[model samples]
Target: MRGTIVTLGGGGFSMADTGITPIDELLLGLTGKRRPRVCFVGTASGDAASYRERFFDAFGARAHASALVLFGQATHAFTAPQILLEQDLVYVGGGSTANLLALWRLHGVPALLEQAAAGGTVLAGISAGMNCWYEGSSTDSFAPLAPLRDGLGWLPGSACPHYFAEPGRAERFGEWVADGTLPPGYAADDGVALVWRDGALAEVVSERPGGQAFAVTAAGETPLEVRLLARF
Candidate 1:
């Protein structure tokens, strides 16, 4: 069965009035007859406390009581996948994308994630959490460091979040897209969410101060033009 993938901006969750907190809507959309088994991965912060207080506050007792909150720094390589396999909603927390991806590769998490998705699990996350799914992504949040590897091949191209908010980010993204360094993909700002279902873009929604999503393709032989899509 095909599953849903929700990509959020840097902020963890958003409010419906503001239009940014699409998580609740995403959850509502995914829920059918049963509650999904949720799991959070890449909590290198070691504890839920290190994450944004809003997460715990928003999720509240629900998050505190989650069955598995895998702190990447503390677990062994072999233990992660077993827990991942049991989850129906796997929410990857934001951290160092390079480190997270490295550890995931080392521990066989990617294959497990793909397995989970194939089994109809919902894969969702914010910032690095979302960036890890696409091809090349800008690590501007953790800048002074170089860009890392192509993301888990769940999607065919690159993803740039907090795209228009950061200065020169859009320019850098344009350069990369034009240079053929990264594939045609998206650029999301604070409150917008880019959703993909059944291997195609199903929706792109805005909340609060909205941002843009671009589809950059090689128009001629070199330069890439950023093509925009309708808001979901």
Candidate 2:
């Protein structure tokens, strides 16, 4: 089945309260479902309560929004298959990619996510969430920028978020891909997302002017052509 996946390097509504994020609006549009149900999976960051509150303040009024908290008392039902598969969009938050993966596997969240994706549910996220879909990614999960090759493999290659925002991200990501520490992949700056449709890249989109995405390889890094979407 054809499915859509949007992986953002950073910049979205996840931690914002000032205004609705354009990138988030783009993700919601991809669902193409009325009053789409958007669920935030916050296993990362230890399901911090502040994260949940910010999420609701930003997304709750616009759509049927809920968050899946894995630690402490569960706010929403822990039924991954029923809840995740039923939603039009599943947005994962950024934090501790390693821990996120571990907990997800422990709770069978990965399988349910795969099922949801196969069913045409839009899967999208920023940072750690973005990293989970590829074969691998560069992350700070270990408190250092390191290559982690244990992705869910929903998409090919690797991913690196905060390409420019982080001091060593672009350089380290390039070195890893070049030396075979990690495979060739995509890197994105804050406010940009790499859009995939049916396992192929359809486009790169950005919320802010000058936000960019790139294709990194042993050869060198080349900018991925991107469209700057206008926000009303």
Query: Where in model 2 is the C-alpha error above 4 Å?
Result: 15-17, 74-81
Ten contiguous residues minimizing lDDT sum, candidate 1: 220-229
Error of 1 at 155 (Å): 0.4
Clash total of candidate 2: 0
Where model 1 places Cα greater than 4 Å from the true spot, the runs are 14-20, 33-35, 43-48, 52-54, 60-79, 218-232
Per-model TM values vs. the true structure = 0.76, 0.95
> What's the lDDT for candidate 2?
0.88
lDDT of 1 by residue, 109-200 (tens): 78887888888777887777778888777665465523554678576577777766667766777677677787766777765667778667
Give the per-residue lDDT of model 2 (tens digit) for 1-232: 2588999999898645565698888988888876899988887778877777778888887889988877865554443445898889999999989899999988888888778888888999889999998999999999989999999888999999999999999999999999999999999999899999988999999988999899999998999999998885
TM-score of predicted structure 2: 0.95
Which pairs clash (backbone N, Cα, C closer than 3 Å) in model 1?
Answer: 14-21, 18-208, 19-207, 20-207
Q: Looking at model 2, report the run of 10 residues with the lowest lDDT sum.
A: 73-82
